[model samples]
Target: MPTARWRKSSYSGGQGGECVEVANVAAVIAVRDSKDPAGPKVTLTASGWCDLARRIKSGEHDLI
Candidate 1:
C-alpha cells in the first residue's frame, strides 16, 4: 500500500500533549496518534467519520 499523507488537527498545539493525525486512505479515514506514527491506527468509513465528528461537536464524548 502507498504511504498515507497524514495531517495533524489545526487545533493541536506545538507542545504536542495528546494529538492525532488523519489521512484519507481510499474509501476510509485513517487516524493515528501523532506521537506514535508506527503504532496502531483506527479506520472509519466516510459516514462513520462524519458521525464521530458530529458527536464530538455535540459534546457527547466530553471528558468534563
Candidate 2:
C-alpha cells in the first residue's frame, strides 16, 4: 500500500536473528517476521503501536 519503508527492528542483529520488520503504512503499522520476509504480516493502528512501544520500553514485558 503506497511506498512504505519497511525496516528491521533495531534489536535485530546482522547475523539473522528472530526479529520483526516494521512498516508504517498510511494510518497503520505493519509487522512481519524477519526470518520470513515473504510471510504474513500483522497491521496495527497508531495508538496500538504506541502502546506496544511504550510497554516494550517500560519493562512491562521484561520478566527479569
Candidate 3:
C-alpha cells in the first residue's frame, strides 16, 4: 500500500483543470489528481522526480 500525502501544486495557483497532487513517498514520488484524491496515482523514482523538476524548471516541457 502507498502512504503518501498529496496537495495542490504550487504552480496551480488554486485553479487549474490539469492540477495534480504530489506526495513524497519513501524513495518515490506519487502523483494524483486533486479533484479525485481517492483515484489512481502514478509513482516515480526519486531520480525521475528530479529529472522532471529539472525539465520543468528549464521550460523543456510544454505546459498549459
Candidate 4:
C-alpha cells in the first residue's frame, strides 16, 4: 500500500486522551491509535467502516 495520510478523528477531544486516527487507503479505511503512529493498525472495507460508524452513532455498543 502507498503511504497513508492520516487525520485525527473529529470526535477526539482537544485534551487528546484515547484518540483515534484514520486514513483512506484505496478501497479501505485505515485506523490506528493516535498515540501509536508507528504501531500496528487495522484496515476495514468502506462498507464495514460505514456500518461500524452507524452502530456507534446508534449506541449499539454502549455499556449497560
TM for candidate 3 is 0.71
lDDT of 4 by residue, 7-49 (tens): 8877799876688888999889999888878888899999999
* Model 2 ranges with Cα > 4 A deviation: 1-3
Candidates ranked by TM-score: 1, 4, 2, 3
- Range of the 10 consecutive residues with the lowest summed lDDT in candidate 3: 1-10
Candidate 2 C-alpha lDDT tens digits along 1-64: 4477888866677775678889998889998887887788899999999999899889898878
Model 1, C-alpha of 25: deviation from truth (Å): 0.3
lDDT (C-alpha, whole model) for all candidates: 0.89, 0.84, 0.79, 0.87
Report the poorest 10 consecutive residues by lDDT, candidate 2: 1-10
Of 1 and 2, which scores higher on TM-score? 1
> 1-64, model 3: which lDDT tens digit per residue?
2456666766885456578878887778888877787889888899998999799889999776
TM per candidate comes to 0.90, 0.77, 0.71, 0.83
lDDT by residue (1-64, candidate 1, tens digit) is 2489998888998877589888999999999898888889999999999999999999999999
Better of 2 and 4 by lDDT: 4
Candidate 1 has its poorest 10 consecutive residues by lDDT at 1-10
RMSD of 2: 2.2
lDDT of 3 at 64: 69
Worst window of 10 by summed lDDT in candidate 4: 1-10
List candidate 3 stretches off by more than 4 Å.
15-18
